[model samples]
Target: MALKLLSALDAAKIQLYHFKAIIIAGMGLFTDAYDLFCIPPIMKLIGRIYYLDHHNSDKCSVMPKETQYKTTPTAVVSTLVSIALLGTAVGQLVFGRLGDRAGRRRVYGLSLGMMVLSSLACGFSICKTRNCVLVSLGFFRFLLGVGIRGDYPLSATIMSEFANKKTRGAFIAAVFSMQGLGILASSIVTMVVCRIFAVSSNEPKSETPDEADLAWRVILMMGAVPAALTYYWRMMMPETARYTALVEQNVVQAAIDMKKVLDVPMSEIAEDSPIRLKPPVLPHPSYPLLSKRFLRRHGVDLFCCAATWFLVDVVFYSSNLLQSQIYHRFIKDNNDVNGYKLAFKVARFQAILAISSTIPGYWVTVYFIDRIGRVKIQMLGFLFMALVYFAIGIPYKYY
Candidate 1:
């Protein structure tokens, strides 16, 4: 038993392409992050461009009129941001099943195609007519979700299958860490756009807020550029060898592909290695995925990981969507005032706060995850979150 365990670990070590695969899969995730987080910073901008401030008048407007220029309604803002999540939900359901059926590489490529298309569709949201623009933005956001959906399961599965066994935990975790990279990129992009808008915003002729709104469209369009490049990158890569072996029942081809990936000659390939010419006789009496053995153990791990992911997204995204407001409060409390400067300050401070919140949690999990196991860490994290929520909820009820 110890020998078998050691062999698995050894096999994992020999596997290098899996790490490459994780990076490739991570690019797709970066796209997901860009599409998902880009909305909030632009939410206020979109509202000003559309229903909120339909006219670009210079009159000193009153209460609701001031709000039209100053604030996007909570409901509208939530709907806009949540629309992307909705796209994610649909994309996940469709792409998850399709990826399993169509092969990971093809499905991955398809997801990218959708991403490029949907991102371009967002540009269409810059319509001259307000109603048309609002409708287009919502539709395109949902279209973006369609692409965002396929990423998680497909990336996780590919990253896991490709990774060397011993490093699987580290590789998967690292792939997710790139999510932060995408977020950081989005924030930077928004900052650049904001700077441009601020510059244009000061122009004698730029009295209209709609002129300022051009910044967001530029940012949205910038996101599509990376996805386009990724699509080109993905086009050059081959299908995962493990996926081919397990799903396609092509052991001979799997071995050949494995050799190419490992850069090993057939003669030098270890005879005792599990990459066999003959397919292993997986146990029968039918559906392995639905079997009691697979369900009780593997299923539970998958369920836990997914649920934890969902919960984290809800809290993190909600906080991010409210980031500007949070920063405004901090500014107000501190009695610091400057719209253009504050926008940039709030954005940077918010990014810093976000990094601070996530990094320790991420590092702690990354450090202990392999040693202690994913399931335990996930469960404990969920429990801690639940307890925090409960304590907060209890206090709120009493107050």
Candidate 2:
């Protein structure tokens, strides 16, 4: 009664290939998070290095004199941080449909390649003036964002199609959990690199031009490492059997591919028999996404998902990208600290925060998602987040 590919995939037992697929798809998500979130801790340092005056260190009455050091305007910093989101918005639209049309495996490696190349290019961004440097960095990061955003739909679709029904949710959750690890890795790597530069220098609080510039570059470029490592494996991966059978309508090829991936013999698949291939007695009309029937069926669900995701991301990205600014207010006010050293401190703090809260929350979700059910967990998460935000807001003035 069911399609050969779907039946095979649903019936297959958990095996090595399942785990391999998770890794292959998950690494892209890992790189995505690392590259996206890595900018926060370093944003202040970027401002200090390029926008602020290096020569002045005068103390101020209300706040640190470093306010005077700012040569780069706040708008420029906001632009550098937000430009990637613009790129991602465009990429999601372009790549989402492209994957379905062009084939997932074919476009998968391209996204990874873009991420690797753009990460490196972002690190190496250079120009004569600060404005030019910012412009170059923004362009590369926009490309990087394009690459990272492509991974979202591709990986989710690939994982979902390839996964067995029994453990499909878990498998997809496992893939997404890698994003938390990626975030943690970015912080840890930045902390280590900053520490190395911090200890090597004789003058800890004084900015060394070479080290300050190199540190941010290294942090940005480190994102490319995981993406590059996974590229070969991703290219070798076969297209999902669902896409092969349903989308491409090649039953035999789909069976063969599933055999290789699932490690099951072709003889085991009774679903592929000729009788099962007979046309349905009554075929349903295929409706476009905006058609009345489609809208009636899925409109509310789609709107809720889109709205919820937008709200969550608005909070998540804003909090993450502006974390350094938040922490800076509480930290010791010192104008003497070099940009690199300050960046190091911020990176370490963020790393601790990620390790303590962010990474653990992800693993918990991965383990409990199937058991607790997604809707319930999501509701609970939203509730907790709301409560936390309310508490913070109520006490905002005290800080």
What do the candidate models score in CA lDDT, each in turn? Answer: 0.67, 0.78
Residue 243 lDDT in candidate 2: 80
Q: How do the residues 1-399 of candidate 1 rate in per-residue lDDT, one tens digit apiece?
A: 123322332374545666667667787777787777777667655544454333433443553333334445677777878888888888898998898778888998898888888888786675767667767888998988888777666777777766667767878887777677677777777777787777767543222255655676777877788777777776676666666666765555655666666655554333344555565555544556767878876898878767877788887777676666544545331212223343455456556754875546665776778999977888888788788668755775453
- Each candidate: RMSD: 5.2, 4.1
Task: Evaluate residue 327 in candidate 1 and report its C-alpha lDDT on the 0 to 100 scale.
Answer: 42
lDDT of candidate model 2 versus the reference = 0.78
Top lDDT hit: 2
Query: Compared to the true structure, candidate 1 yields what TM-score?
Result: 0.80
lDDT for residue 395 in candidate 2, whole number 0-100: 79
TM-score of 2: 0.89
Question: Model 1, residue 10: displacement in angstroms?
Answer: 6.9
Write the residue-wise lDDT of candidate 2 on 160-272 in tens digits: 99888878888998998888788788888887877887778675354434456778888999998999987888888778888877766656667767877788767765463
Worst 10 residues of 1 by lDDT: 331-340
User: Against the true structure, what is each candidate's TM-score?
Assistant: 0.80, 0.89
In candidate 2, which residue ranges exceed 4 Å CA deviation?
Answer: 53-72, 202-204, 270-285, 330-333
